[model samples]
Target: MSRFMSAALCALFVFSMTTANASAADAPGKAVYDINCSTCHKDGVMNAPKLGDKAAWAPRIKQGIAVLTKNSITGFKGKVGMMMAKGGHPNLTDAQVKSAVEYIVLQSK
Candidate 1:
């Protein structure tokens, strides 16, 4: 192949790889969890579910992701503890909250 053509292909390959890696690492849900969820979930603050805690998450998971997302967005007061709407982050859009919920569920299960 021509030198210029080879260089162009290499550049394209690099660009595509970089984009894919970035997207995979910074998935919407993971990003939201890093910012909004790590605080409570990481430490189980105020009884928040810990990441990868399948036993703790079993009942909630049975309730389904949709309900879990709703509770995360609208706020849930459970016997263990209460979660404020959007984890008390008013700036969070419903989509963001849902993403966080999905991320947590994915990790737990």
Candidate 2:
């Protein structure tokens, strides 16, 4: 094959691989939350809000997304209890934490 054709094929291969990796990484937030937060949050341990429990989540939900996201990322010790940094997952990106919070909020609602 010509050099130009080989280069094009290489580029296409790289593009396809990158897209596949991105999609794999983009697995739903609920899955992330289940793997991470559900340990405590699912059963309301340490006063962590239980999944799908709107009443338990109501007050925090009222605080709005921005505040909740901040708390989730930075950690907080509030009247309810302590939330660890990144919900104790230091490796989680801010976007991932936000997505997890969104999943929780959606389920709670």
Candidate 3:
């Protein structure tokens, strides 16, 4: 193969790898979000707040990440609705819940 052709192939491979890694890194909590949070958050079921509703999340975001993480971990009872502890998945650790919360917050914002 010509040197030019080899260099082009190498650049393409590097670009594809970088794109994949960037996409993966962008969603740090995607796994936890998918497994635990998607059910309610996807459709705003029981007022759970849809994944990208800045209006719905604005107030909660104002409350700050620590509070959001705590609510996600310990469960929350708000005027509109409630969230179960660990998203009703008792097996989920605090870190998992927090990761999911961070993902949700990131998307919402």
What stretches of model 1 exceed 4 Å from their correct place? 1-25
* lDDT ranking from best candidate downward: 3, 1, 2
Write candidate 3's Cα lDDT for 1-109 as tens digits.
6999999999999999998688658775887899888999999899888999999999999999899999888899998899999889989888878888888888898
Give candidate 3's total backbone clashes: 0
Error of 2 at 60 (Å): 0.9
Per-residue lDDT tens digits for candidate 2, residues 2-109, read: 999999999999999998678647665776798789998998899888999988889989999889999999998988789899889999989888889888998997
**Residue 10's lDDT in candidate 3:** 96
TM-scores, one per candidate: 0.76, 0.74, 0.75
Q: Which parts of model 2 have CA positions greater than 4 angstroms off?
A: 1-27
Winner by TM-score between candidate 3 and candidate 2:
3
> After aligning candidate 1 to the native by TM-score, how far in Å is the CA of 109 from where it should be?
0.8
Check candidate 1 and list the clashing pairs: none
**Which pairs, if any, clash in model 2?**
none
Model 1 per-residue lDDT at 64: 94
Rank the models by TM-score, top first: 1, 3, 2
Minimal lDDT window, size 10, model 1? 19-28
Please list the C-alpha lDDT of all candidates, in the order they appear: 0.88, 0.88, 0.88
